[model samples]
Target: MTNRALVIQDNHHQTFDNDAFMQARNLKAEYCNSGTDALHAIKSHRYRCILVSMDMQKENPVEIIGALRHAENTSGLSPTPIIVAGKDFKLTQSDIGRLNISAQIRSHHLK
Candidate 1:
């Protein structure tokens, strides 16, 4: 298995320094600046984990998780762990259960 991760973040609101995180973890990372690109990357590659920025402007992080989950289901792939990263977004327990999110990482924790 590849020690790789997919990072989905909007270009404009890049608050988290994903490179530093990846470097610290000793993992290779593929960055997707949009949901469309992220979807395409998810289809083509398998990641150890996916880190999605919650501060996206064009796409809702929940929506992205839903789509990725659906794709994994239809493709008969194991669910990849997803970690939501952001500064001020709150994910309700209901949303977390529904989305099957693996974990969440606040920006402060990353630093």
Candidate 2:
């Protein structure tokens, strides 16, 4: 089975360094440079790991994450593990949400 990961980022350019790190680990990543793109992609594919950024969509990644979770809740589809990437954002809501499979990846560590 392919261990694919979906990463949602508003600025794919600003995320290059982190992408390289994931690639080095042999992770197959599907990145969307905007929330709109990510939402469209998720409707078409399944990912084991989901990485979301707070700065996405000009500062509305929360909506993207919520949308994913909502899809699972309403459709009874299996929820993928999510890794929220950001500086000011916290995982509290994601933890309590329907997506029990989740984690956090700080953006600053992209250095």
Candidate 3:
């Protein structure tokens, strides 16, 4: 497993303070402020985990997940595990099946 992680968020403030957690675990963390930038980073780097915030301002979180899936499929890369973060995300069953979300981290649980 890579000792790296990618966090996709519209803002720099991470709900879980993931950077510090990663540091404590001796892992490297990278942050992307946009979905496009996140996709580029995913293609170029290897991450042990991908954490995406559902409360983005510019792009829809579902679309970002779709784009990431498409990129992986087109490039013949193994599926990268993804975790979603939100305080009030309510994805339908179809949406969850489509994205294959591995897990969710609530905003409150971060603390």
Best of the candidates, TM-score? 1
Clashing pairs in 1: none
Measured on C-alpha atoms, candidate 1 has an lDDT of 0.88
Clashes of 1: 0
lDDT of 3 at 29: 74
The alpha-carbon lDDT assigned to residue 31 of candidate 1 equals: 87
Per-residue lDDT of candidate 1, residues 1-111 (tens digit): 889999988773577778888999888989898878888998999999999999898789889888988988999989998999888899999988888899888888887
> Total clashing residue pairs per candidate?
0, 0, 0
Q: What CA RMSD would you report for each candidate?
A: 1.2, 2.8, 1.7
Model 2 Cα lDDT, one tens digit per residue, 42-63: 7788886787776565757766
Per-model TM-score, in order, reads 0.93, 0.74, 0.89
Model 3 misplaced regions, further than 4 Å: 20-26
lDDT of 2 at 16: 31
CA deviation > 4 Å runs, candidate 2: 57-59, 91-101, 108-111
Q: Which residue pairs in model 2 clash with each other? A: none
